[model samples]
Target: MAKLSLCGGRAAVTAGSRLLASGLGAVAGGERYTNNFFLYDCSSAEKKLPDHKDEDGLAMAVGSDTILAHAFSSSGSFFALTDDNKRLILFRTVPSWQCLSVRSVARRCTALVITTAEDRIFVADKSGDVYSFSVTDPQGEARLELGHLSMLLHLAVSPDDQYIITADRDEKVRVSLLAAPHNIVSFCLGHTEFVSQLLVLPWAPDLLVSSSGDQTIKLWEYVTGREVQSCDLSTSHRQDGDEDKQRFAVSRIAASCSGSHIAVLFDCVPTVHVFQFDAASRQLLPGQEISLEHGVWDVAFDASSGLWILQEDKDEVVLIYRLADGKWQRSLNEESMERLSNHLRDNWTLMEGCSDTESPFRNLYKASYDNMAHYLQKKEERILEQKQKKRKGAQQETTQQTKVLHPVTPSS
Candidate 1:
């Protein structure tokens, strides 16, 4: 393997007969890699979910079909996919590929989330309704609804699945207790414009992050919903004047599972900005910024693989970047890419086929509440039984040791 260090990271290239046979084993050990000079056909990468459509003659547009939002469940077995239409779709990975679940939300689902316990999927809709669906049930169940005065733009579920924090078009952020049914714990109010995104740090229950159209990202204490740190994207660019201000729109945001790093995708800039936050000082320091050709629509970090998935809007390409070396690669084949593009076009037409009075129902599924609760209860019981068995084995060993040795017992 030939290893080279460049631009704040190191890159290792595998040299082997296999590499020669494949031209480049871009896919290796579950991580994909590509250099700055190379571009691969990423059209074949599996479509995780079907296209979401709207009936109002405003079916979710194409170039905008770029996953505007995404969320990984606590178990990571499932993920929620939301497109620019803000419609929500649930995807579960089968042995071969990811498949859609029965539960789907109709409103423009801007954000998707799963409770930490993996029992429920929390969907924040543009219509201001936060819908909760039970994941365990075959029939999607709707639990409680949190109605916002304005459009519910974003949502983040805590690792414990006890709390759900939401951002709305009203520029207000609210935290509600998921377990307690309809309890509004607190509200974070400060942003002057629509709150675009919300991210909860994996390890920190108290730390919640929000990005707003006000051109800033704010970090808050989950318990209090109090703003602890704030950073202005407007200051990121050195250029002055209204042009710079107009250029800055914080589109998508993500926090590394470790809580050490944050990635912010801006609409105006072609580069993704990384920031490191100091918990002690509550300050955000600029980290490395990686530039790409197309504007970034969404960014997701796979902590297990240490890979970053960046979806670009213009070319409709999903770029995979290795965190260790900053090597960028594209997934999917040219044929698959064309298929996806065509699929999007076909989906638009299908969406257009729906009349204004008709509801859009192509990719959406709904599951029921009682079935979800029963499934979770059964799952917990099984886990507890396994734990009890392990404990019994340990006790048996201790009891045998405590038994007294009686050499003469046979004689008696």
Candidate 2:
């Protein structure tokens, strides 16, 4: 299952699979679950659908569409999603949620970013290429923007729309000119593993926040490729497990519009770490740890700075927390929460085989193998065996000599 905070936190979207027992559905489901997309407007306490001309057909066809990446334009006036079908779907959200266009991508997309201009959307695919599509011209052909040697994990655009930031499996954060992507601006280097998430601060356009499989969240001056600060997740204490010794990849990072708060969620970990951004000191200070009853899937900070969480619980899949008296308290949009949770619970079966999907971060971790040490140990064993063989041969020779010398005595 996957979830995204959308429409500047006024809405959220969750993706899961629905079990299909038939031919095309079963083939589309493959080893993964079938895509069953749900979009909820938190403010209105209702679900929204893509206003496609053939809305009914779109709903039926989406059962096989596994969304690989999605992002909302900086202004939240536009939303975009890419799927395994190699299709990019754009939606306009200003007046009402409606499908703007559906275009084909070069390859299976891994990440997406919409420029602040709201005119173009950038898509990163598993083949290590980024493609640009026009938001204004729905039928405009996709243009090849840039290429990476490794699969791109995430993409972020500068608020000014001058620079495009991309993170890849090679642990590189690249800053490139939006107009001329071939012109490299700088590279934000330091992460030793795959960079999974990237966010250009909404409030501080110059500041870039990135998370990695290396178990660290880094802040960067993206334009200059300078790392500002880093928070290591290994040191975080979680009461439930030996988390201090365990390493977890940062799956999501979200910052409040006020720039005062940042929320981070570690993959497979049930706790959310809220960090206070000290603008005065230019520091990210540890703030609060909100432990959940079940494993968390995703987290986002709403426009009001409220934290919304999607977790593993079937009964309560959606959780919203607000800061009150310096503590994070559960704030219920009871009706809204119920509707969202029910939608997930009713289709929980679609998420059953999801555990079989290999986590991309797992391979990002450096593998340790001591080939030299094994070779040396085998060499030592061979030397010991040769020594024993020689000893046995020497003993047999001595026995033979004794028998030859004592032959005369035996005859007498």
Candidate 3:
């Protein structure tokens, strides 16, 4: 297997493969060049935004029906994507992404991680259960491991395989012994809301970084339950004005493989903020912000060369950007994503339609407040019409009474 050198600080490199934007494996290990290709606007932030082919200037689109979760192995030899329908597809990433096996879980899988040893794969689901399976297991039998009380939002294993770190929606980061997951080491509790993403730096095993719905990111040493640092970045707000700005939360975060750069992003947002990570001091410095062409769902970047960005509006789920002159720039052309590809779940249809009684949204009210306002508006209009009618009728009656009282006996 050929390895891509991700270390020159910021040097020009070459591309071994045209990045396939739909898969996560390519950017995880693919060789990219910093040749300053004219295809994409390099450092578009430094100047005015330029008009590109696609709206928001995105290169390509991956039009999968629905993709729930995706991840690449530690060695970058394998990649997997979990469909919204609970089917998990594994791919061999070395020569090319070849479909290895497919397994369907009972619930929607939220996160996946391959062990540092690269022998096992673990997947966490929204139902709070974590399952482990062999990497090469064609059967794809997911064995049950420890479980959480709330929905498992993220998963991470220590470099030495001593502890398994799991973040839950209940704002708790639990550290459990992998060998006996039932024996939890400690709970890193600081976030006020749901925990969304988790990362333990490869070079610094004791340090852990986590992002959460409380619109903040925190660094912790899980074994000792110590909070090292925290940053408030929850700026993305709901445009509808129905929800609070902090509700957007810090959902997705990626650190460069070299561990020098950390990127943070949010769901339904087109902007990304990069932070410089000082490995020695274990502190994160705010860096430049990159605006994308469309709303993005997730983002991942290599420490040295490339970033895998997933967009929501475009058909291409994954977009590649290469590091150039200390700044990450979009390099891979849009044509690379033009060719339509079939994923493992390409033939599967999103299961839809349900009886009113069985619908999960059955109890959901359609903003009865808004409806009540409309109702009151109509009621006021009706009342005004009735008042006008009564006034007209009273006028006619008064005129008739006057005539009767007058006893008009003349010309009329």
Q: What does candidate 2's lDDT look like per residue over 1-412, in tens digits? A: 5664634323545454221111111111123112323443212211233333343555323324666677777766677877655677777764456677777676778888888888998999987899999999987999999999988889888888899889999899999999999999999999998899998887777899999888788999888999999888777844456545655588889887664788998877788999887888787889889988787878877556767797776777779888889888999755445555666577676545443234547876777799999999999999999999999999999999998887755455
Top lDDT: which candidate number?
2
Q: Which candidate is the best by TM-score?
A: 2
Checking candidate 2 for backbone clashes, the offending pairs are: none
What is the model-wide C-alpha lDDT for candidate 1? 0.55
Clashing pairs in 3: 56-293, 61-315, 61-316, 62-315, 62-316, 256-303, 257-303
Question: Relative to the true structure, how large is the alpha-carbon lDDT of every model?
Answer: 0.55, 0.74, 0.62
**Which candidate do you rate higher for TM-score, 1 or 2?**
2
- lDDT by residue (337-385, candidate 1, tens digit) is 3332343333332223112221111112122269888999999999999
Each model's TM-score, in the order given?
Answer: 0.59, 0.79, 0.62
Question: In terms of lDDT, which candidate is stronger, 1 or 2?
Answer: 2
Runs off by more than 4 Å, candidate 3: 1-65, 235-244, 308-412
Q: Per-prediction RMSD in angstroms?
A: 27.6, 9.9, 14.0
lDDT of 1 at 298: 45
* lDDT score, candidate 3: 0.62
